[model samples]
Target: MRRVPGRPFEPEEYVLETNTILFRVFSTGGMVPRTVTDFNPGKGDRTRFAFFGDPTVPVLYAAESEEAAVCESILHDVPSGPGAVLYESFADRVCAPLAPTRDLSLVSLMGDGLFKLGTQARYVTGTMASQYTRTVRWAEAVHEAGFDGLVWMSNRRNTDRAFVFFGDRVEAGDLVALPGTGRIFAAGAGFDWLADYLTSLKIEILIP
Candidate 1:
């Protein structure tokens, strides 16, 4: 919380850091103040209880953000056609909680010199009027399900891609394997960075 020498500290400034991640708190403009637990402002009306290691707590309230517009398309912004704009007004908001997409522990779990090939499918929502309605109804379900954010895939038109509503709980290796689920393949924008990391390990991506 120490301010840099000679630099005026910003009142809205906040930061969270863990062993593997770091990001700044842009603003609480979209925070559900009533829903937030243990909110205590250090100063005038500003919450001082920031810097959370747990991804469940939102770090920023994304208002009219492109990320929000894209992820919340199921709410009614996508079908209008490509380049469809959403969140045009202040009524729309997306809470950006921090979450880990990649689990680096896999490096050790694989053992020395051992390599495995796996497919990673881009996560997308199912295409169906009923599905979109379900999505719209589930707008608040994310908070209920304890997800950081609704992670979207690359394709916007094809909503049929695999979409994980509760993606905040997702880890890097969740797709490749899990305790009881066995092997499966799914990718998300949050894990886009892993593509490069996986390639460094000699893993290849195949499109069918």
Candidate 2:
């Protein structure tokens, strides 16, 4: 597999139906609203699919399931061990359920989709954080190819699919919040449920 796949190839497309509920974990303290479908402006840390040169081309990530959302976001950096996650990590974080108002056409990076692009899944999905600079170039290429977003198997949860939408292509009104479904991760039923879920994975959250 090449470090970076050639650009302008015919990418396999995946259509995300409007009925599919996507899960996203976000910080309540962040500039974007909890229930809004705003993209990250690339003002902070680098992400796997963020634009390398143009910070103006924003991105928003979501997962197919709640477990995938938590694993990909909140539990992303936590190591696989007892008490590996800190309680402070949960502060101000919340998960919102969202769905597209209309069908979204996205470039598929899984299965035969990889073959269409002349690359393997590992090169695109299994890359480490240090390789984001190289990985992001693929996103730029995909965006330039006129795709709305990219969809692939989640690195943290392979059984689930992860999605990244380009802000320049995907409008804010394209996605809508599911009414009364947002959950705050730090306290109450949200905390209790998450604690139980983490316990099943042999990860304990130490409260300071």
Strongest candidate by TM-score? 2
Q: Rate the local accuracy (lDDT) of all candidates.
A: 0.26, 0.84
lDDT for each residue of candidate 2 in 1-208, tens digit (9 for 90 to 100)? 6668684568899999986899998877755554447677776787888855444798899999989999888877776566568888877888888899889999999999998888887787777788888888788888888888999998878999999998888897898888875777789988888888999999888889
Supply the global lDDT for candidate 2. Answer: 0.84
TM-score for predicted model 1 compared with the true structure: 0.24
Model 2, stretches more than 4 Å misplaced? 30-36, 53-55, 81-83
Residue 26 lDDT, candidate 1, scale 0-100: 24
TM-score, one value per model: 0.24, 0.93
Question: Residue 134: error of model 2 in Å?
Answer: 0.4
After superposition, candidate 1 runs with Cα above 4 Å error = 1-78, 82-97, 101-124, 132-208
**CA error at residue 170 for candidate 1, angstroms:** 6.6
Candidate 1: tens digits of C-alpha lDDT, residues 62-104: 1123333233332233343223222222123222333233431
Q: List pairs with backbone clashes in candidate 2.
A: none
